[model samples]
Target: MSPIYFSLVTILLSIITITHATTITVVNNCDYTVWAAADPGGGRQLNKGNTWNLNPAPGTKMARIWGRTGCNFDGNGNGNCQTGGCGKLVCNPGNWGTIPKTLFEYTLAQPNNPTDTIDISLIEGFNIPISFSPTSNSGALGGNCRTIRCTADINGQCPQNWRVPGGCKSPCTSQGIGTCGANGDSRFYKQRCPDAYSYPNDDPTSTFSCPSGTNYRLTFCP
Candidate 1:
């Protein structure tokens, strides 16, 4: 190919790369307001029945999203939350707020791998009941993404040591507890929501994936 034609092809490819996007919609299904937070993205105040759509850079990996309850932010989006606060209404890039937080983690599709990996994580702890799942298109495109959720009233059931204002603390975060799969506390979470990560190394059964460009819905209190 000639130099001019090669340059044109390169520009076309770059445009295509930049234009391709994936979306993760955050929905609040609880009866109260939730400060929906995300790393690599940001945070949004989602009222009951409201939603916020996040479009992170393609191939974004090792990122997380969670909810903060009992928040009081100023007009400039600065304040604290009773649970899962990062010191501001909008969290800085790559910031996973302090626990107790019910974390939603994921790795979007990469160039070589057209599948997205995701999981619901209680490693930090649990606040609101949450669910993470791919939209209907996953099955339509031959993707096998499955929904993962922790809908039990963890705060009410948590041990006294792990109790927080708006959430439950994981033994893993509060202290160096036993492996999530073996500990009684972790067992409590697992028995209620078997599909989520009770501890950091809880993979195999916790990690899941979907087709490339698949859309996702993260529902709070689902």
Candidate 2:
């Protein structure tokens, strides 16, 4: 083989090798936001199929996924999906409001500033937010989370929007304690009432801290 031909073939092989060596890892669940890894290959929209292109370059994961929940709960962005008054609560308009959908969020814990969302090729598993229904039937003003019930004891009279309407339901109840006490301790508190609103869990002296051995591992922006 001629020296020139040999050189050309070697260069082409190097390029192919480099293109096929990309790899990335994505850790996603149904909690906060929908996260997708930007594959370097730039394939077609594959998230709908749970498939990603070839791995992106190291520190090349960049992209903003829309919040999964509260997509179109309300017709318009008016938070009122109704004509008379029989409208389900729409996505709360304004800055960083609650979403009606349930999802998970994955964040990269690397100590590097990614130029874009695609610059990070890995997800921080420790950063997962298990979004819970904040004040079920009723919506709390703010600084409050949804209430989950284990039984239909209160006839769905928890709060304005907390009542489950039909019957009682239990979701993600076996997490820890319904309400954690201050000093990072645990007490025999009621788990979520069937029809209850925002119960006082953390206040001046009721900071809901994780159990003694548990850590504050949340992925969403606190």
Candidate 3:
């Protein structure tokens, strides 16, 4: 091939590679509507049995997705939510979802590597049941490439002092616990969801990684 032809081919391949994106599907199985919120992708209302598909920018490595309940928004994306409110239809990329909400955390493809980190985190507390799983089975890189969830009805069993209307606050936030070790609240959450991050430092068994190209699905109230 001529030099110019080779250069053009390389450019085209680069464009194609840059355009490729990882798919993330969010599904709602709750009886009521849930405002699905993400840092980079913003927010959207998902009624029961609805699904929202997102393709975040490749540069967006770390992101969080959660559900907000009891929201009232206008056509212009102006509104408030009872939980995880960002005051708009599409949450600002700079804004974070409220605490006492379950979070699906992800670290997308890194430089020169095809591995992606994923986990269901209860460190912010629990508002609803959630599960994170790889949609495709091809990226099973051993150890952490498995489905994880916090399906327990934690709100119903929340301790009186940590109980909130729609969620349960972690004792670390409510009772000023030092860490999530050997504490009643930590024990409560860990016992229910062993695969989730019950505290900030919980990583040995909580974090998991998979091949970057693998698609992901997050289900709410599952």
Colliding residue pairs in candidate 3: 77-89
Give the Cα RMSD of candidate 2. Answer: 16.0
Writing each residue's lDDT as its tens digit, candidate 1 over 1-222 gives 999999999999888765456788999999999999999778989999999999888889989999999999998888999989888888998677888888888898887878778898888888999988777555544444777788987888888877878888887875563544457767888888898888777887888888767788999988
Candidate whose TM-score is highest = 3
Candidate 3, RMSD to the unseen true structure: 2.6
Give me the candidate number with maximum lDDT: 1
| Residues 164-211, model 2: lDDT tens digits | 322121221223235423231112112222122212242332211111
Better of 1 and 2 by TM-score: 1
Instruction: Return the number of clashes found in candidate 3.
Output: 1
lDDT of 2: 0.25
Note the Cα lDDT for every prediction shown.
0.84, 0.25, 0.83
Give the Å shift of residue 58 in candidate 3: 2.6
| Model 3 misplaced regions, further than 4 Å | 1-20, 175-182
Clash pairs, model 1 backbone: none
lDDT of 3 by residue, 15-92 (tens): 866545678899999999999999888888899999999887664566989999888988899998877788898999
Report each candidate's C-alpha RMSD, comma-separated, in the order given. Answer: 2.8, 16.0, 2.6
Candidate 2 stretches with Cα past 4 Å from truth are 1-20, 25-49, 58-68, 72-222
TM-scores of all candidate predictions against the true structure: 0.88, 0.22, 0.89
